[model samples]
Structure formats: C-alpha cells, structure tokens
Target: MWEALVQPFAEFGFMRRALLGCIAISVGATPVGVFLLLRRMSLTGDAMAHAILPGAAVGYLVAGLSLGAMTIGGLLAGIAVALLSGFVTRVTALREDASLAAFYLISLALGVLIVSTRGSNVDLMHVLFGTVLALNNSALILLCSIASITLLALALLFRPLVLECADPQFLRAVSRLSAVTHFTFLALVVLNLVGGFHALGTLMVVGIMIVPAAAARFWAISIGGLILAAVTIAVAASVCGLLVSYHFGLPSGPAIILAAGLAYGLSLTFGPTGSFAARVHPYRHADA
Candidate 1:
C-alpha cells in the first residue's frame, strides 16, 4: 500500500515537483482562505483570482510563457484591482463587495478577450488550466518563496487580523492599523493567487484556497484550529490529487480541486462540528 502511494512520486521527477508545488500552495493559500471565510469574503478571493487574468494574459502576449513575466503581470493586475475596489468603496457610495464585483467582471472579460484574440486555443487552455506536471525549478522557487512570505506576513498580522475580523469597529477605534491591515491582507491574497496561478490556473486556484478553509469550518471553531485543519485538508488533497492524476491520466489542477471538494463533502456529513451526523445526534447535557 505504501509503495503504491509512494512509487509515482519516487519514480517520476515531474510527479515529485508537482507534489512539492502543490504542497507549497496548500500551505500558503489555506491560511488566507481561513481568514477570507471568517471575514465573509470567500467570493472576494474568487474575484481576485479572476482579476489577475488580464495581466497574466498580457504577460503571455509580451513574453510568450516566461514565468517571471506572467507572475509580474498577474501580481500587478491583482493589486491594482484590489486597491481600486477599495478606493471606490471609500470614495463612493458603493460597497466594497459591489465595487470588487464590478472590477473583477471587467478584468475577467478583458483578460479572456486578450487571450482569445492574441493567442491560440492551446495558449488559452494553458493560461486557464495551467500545466502542473511541467513545473520547472523557477516555478518551484516562486511557490516556495510566496509560501514563506505568506507565513511571515500572517504571523505579523495575526493579532490585527483577528481583531479586524472579530470587531471591525472596535479595531478601527483602538488602532489606526485597521486600513493598513486590510490592504496588506489583500496584497497577500494577490501574492498567493499569482503564485497559485502558475500551477492551478486562475479559475481553479481559488478552489485550493477557499474549499479547504470552508471544509475546516465543519471541524474547528477557533481561528487557530481552523487554520491547522484547513492546512491538513489541503495537503492531503494535494497528495491524493497528484496520485490520482498520475494513475488516471487526468489533469492535475482539476484533480486537486476535486479532491478538496470530496474532503469538504465528507466534512459536511461527518465532522463533529455542526455536521449532519452531529446535528442528528446531539450531545446531552445535565444541569449542575
């Protein structure tokens, strides 16, 4: 059993690289996801994912498939959209969510238009779906670097972030770091999404971020518990997804997301925290 599970990664360099890339992404993306879920900005993560597309597409237009070009393009586009949406929310009557929705829609359309017009169908597929099995050393380094940065940023932002999520008004009243914390968090979201796009593509990378965090909610109530559970779920899903992709000749990105979806399904049904089984058989309490 161990050999069956370990053989592909041991035998194939591509499989090993893919495994490492996915693990890095899982570690970096899951914590951001937990906070996004806590702040009820799950869909915001999705929006930011799509918002990076045009910049990546433009990068492809300018430099073919160069990793550095696409990474820079996607990062710029994502940060621009995030900052723009926040600015609109502050200056205008529109809410942040609504402003974000507007910008992301425009960004998605523009990106698709650019790719479809300037690139071939094959290029479109590569941009939209990613090629996980073909990761080079540079891509691996980028993923690892992003993961490291994310961990450090989260560590620094932990207390402010928790306060921001738990009591926004109180946090604002107590500290001027509220806005700084929010935008910094958004920048991290952009950074991780850009990194994830190299492996999972824009459409599916958000799945790695959001789904595991959502599933962890079924098992953990505290912020720390949720982060730990989400990371565990994400890493396990990455491993299973890679093995299934290797054995079944399936696309790696979708396989990973689907594996995460399965975890979510099980967590929903069987987890001890507000799951269906838990609801059906409530724990009895006695008066003291």
Candidate 2:
C-alpha cells in the first residue's frame, strides 16, 4: 500500500510539482501566521485569503492559466484590499475591524462576479477548488520563489515586526521605521497569500497560513520555539495530506488544509494556551 501510494511521484511530473509546492507553502506560511495570531490579526489574514479570489479571477481574465499573470494580479488585488481597509479605518468613524468586514464582503462578491463573467463554473472550480495534481513546473517555481522572498523578509524584519506588533506606540516613539514595517509586512503577506492561494484556494489558505502556527503555540513559550513547532506542523500537514491524497484520492489542497485543521483543533483542545484541552486536563492541578 505504501509503495502503491508513493509510486506516482516517481512517474508523474505534476505530482512531483504538487509535492514540492505543498512543502514550500507549508514552511513559508506558519511563521507569519503565528505572528498574525499573536497580533490578533488572524482576521486580516482571513481577509487576505478571501481577497485572492478576485485577484485570481482578474489574473485568469488577463492571462489565462499562466501562473505569473495570476500571481501578479492576485498580489495587486491583495494590496488594494489591504490599503482600502486601512483607508476606511483612518478616514471614517468605522473601526479597523468593521472596515475589514466591509472590504472582505466587497472583495468576495467582486471576485465571484468577475470569475462568472470570464468563464464557466469549471474554471471557477480551478480557481477555487484548485488542482494540485495539475500543477506545472512554472506554478511550482512561482510558489517557491514567493515563499523564499517571504522567508527572507520575515527573517530580516523579525525583531521589529514582533516589537511593533507588541507595541506600535513604543515602536513609533523610538523608530521611524514603523510605517515601513506596517506596509512591508502587508506586502509580504500579499505575496504569500498569492502564492499560497493557488495551492489552498481562498477558503483554505488561512489554514495553511495560521493553523500550524497556532497549534505550535500550545507547546512553546518562546518565539523561536513557536516558529520551529509551527514549521514542523506545517510540514507534517503537507506530507500527510499529500500521502492521503495519493492513496485515497483526496483533493490535495483541502486534504492538506484539513490536516492542518486537525492540528489546530488538537492544539486548541489540548494545547497549553488555555485551549479547551488545557481546561479539561488542568495540567497544573493534575501535576499538583
């Protein structure tokens, strides 16, 4: 059974591409996701995930199924949504959360309409459901390139990003780098979302981005521990999902997402981060 399941990688180019893409996305998404969870901006990442559909639709219209065109279009749309959300919060009485709600709904609706106008439901399925087995080398390279850049940027900005997230006021008072930090993270997020969306689709991208990181938080106290755990969980989810997909014919993207979801669920229920599991188990009481 194991040989039968694993045999496809030795023969199919697309399957090979899918496996590598999944690995890249898994490694890339969790670190930023953990930070987003820390900042209470999980919703922002969710918003970005939804925002991709429109970007994808526009990309399809602009250049068919080409990965580069789709990625560029998605990045532009992702940035636009982020900027608009920022603008509405600043200019109006509406709070940041409320502005995000409005933008998320608007972007999703627009994406649906654009995709509908351009192609049939089948094409929409390609954008939304995704075809991991259909991934080409071009798409795989795009995902890897985006992930590499994201990883580099995050490494360089790790200190400031964590500090700024913890206290924007202190950062603002101490360093003029605050503004650059804000948009730079968002820009990186845009790239990550675009790259990841092709694999997980909008609905499931947040899982890839956040679930592993959130899961890892349950077991670790330090940022480094958290990041390492998140990476491990992300990789595990990808490899596990790929195996499930190969053997059982599950959809690779959602299979991986569901795998991530399982990790998050387990962590949430049993993790030390005040999850339901912690409450039920009462580690302190049990130990005492």
Give the C-alpha miss distance for residue 78 in model 1, angstroms. 0.6
Per-residue lDDT over 18-99 for candidate 2, one digit per residue giving the tens place of the 0 to 100 score: 8888788877777888888888888889888788778888889988977888888888888988899899989989998888
User: By lDDT, who's the top model here?
Assistant: 1
For each candidate, the alpha-carbon lDDT, in order, equals: 0.94, 0.82
Cα lDDT of model 1 by residue, 1-288, tens digit:
888799999999999999999999999999999999999999999999999999999999999999999999999999999999989999999999999999999999999999999999988888888888989999999999999999999999999999999999999999999999999999999999999998998998999999999999999999999999999999999999999998898999999999999999999999888889878866722221
Q: Count the backbone clashes (under 3 Å) in each candidate.
A: 0, 1
User: Which residue pairs clash in candidate 1?
Assistant: none
**TM-scores of the models, in the order given:** 0.97, 0.92
TM-score of 2: 0.92
